[model samples]
Target: MDETVTAVIDDVVARAAAHDADEPDRLRRWRVLEPDAGRLLWFLVQSSGARDVVEIGTSHGVSTLWLADAVRSTGGHLSSVDADPDVQDAALANLVRAGLDAHVTFGTGDGGAALAGLDEQSVDLLFLDAERTEYPGWWPHPVRVLRPGGVLVVDNAFSHADEVAPLAALIDEHPGLTSTTVAVGKGELLALRSR
Candidate 1:
């Protein structure tokens, strides 16, 4: 990331933190990804040379910005999904401010619907940071769309353990996936599909 991008990310992170603090209801807040996790996403996209990236949650676009920035360098693209149009708008504005909007496509709808529409085994990286409870219902799509050797990253693994455990366990036990948990921001359950 360049100085300009770094500045933009810092600004967004500050704004999101304030927004989240002011919102009493957790659902109403913009739960931005931690900087370290965002950087990890950026590095993964670039190092893997991922040409197709999908992000399930785009709160304030902090994670989207990081992904898009990485894809910009790799000549790839990022598709970000969020159910809330207003949140997606905020994310889009942030992306535009960072000059990374061109690298992303926004989808405002049910994440499962968005995932179902993707071609089988077409995605290189799938990041899940949406509602934990809904992950189980969306399980089939993620498993179907991720190519062999593709990565699946689930956020809030440790933070919201009970809510995400079912999906995490499924991934961990799946015959086609090799999975592990990492103590990053909120914890991340990472998996790679068998080739």
Candidate 2:
């Protein structure tokens, strides 16, 4: 990564770490994206020229805030979904703190159901970080919603490798998508829709 990109990732990590340490409740079950994960996410968004992004998990809004920042810089918009209302509220507050409220739209409820309501091929980027075991269930909807040449980023893919086998198989069999798994911050799978 370039120096400029490195600096941005550092800044984001610093902020997230500070906030995570301050809020014990928020840190309980939440695993905020580390610096490398954040950098990869930022790179993916920028490289894909993704304007309309969807995030499946919004725990404390750290990753949400990161995505919001990318969207704001790209003059894009982010639709973030979380099942927990409290986490959603925290995410909203974090975005506001980052001065990114205008770029993000929050949906609080069942992430799968919320995503199902979106139009097919409407999302340019999809970030999955919800229930680890239910990843396959939540995987297809985002895949269907992403336009050609869009990207799908699934977190914890390797950590829950056995559970996500079906998803891994789908990615392997599907000709329209190519996937790469990176072991960063609990492992992330990046699937790009073939052009």
Clash number by candidate, in order: 0, 0
Candidate 2's displacement at residue 40, Å, is 0.9
lDDT of 2 by residue, 149-177 (tens): 89988887777777667777787777889
lDDT scores in order:
0.90, 0.77
In candidate 1, residue 136 scores what lDDT? 90
**Candidate 2 steric clashes:** 0
Each model's Cα RMSD: 0.9, 3.8
Q: Evaluate model 2: give its lDDT.
A: 0.77
The segments of candidate 2 whose C-alpha lies over 4 angstroms from its true place after superposition are 1-28
Candidate 2 positional error at 34, Å: 1.9
- Could you estimate the TM-score for every candidate? 0.97, 0.83
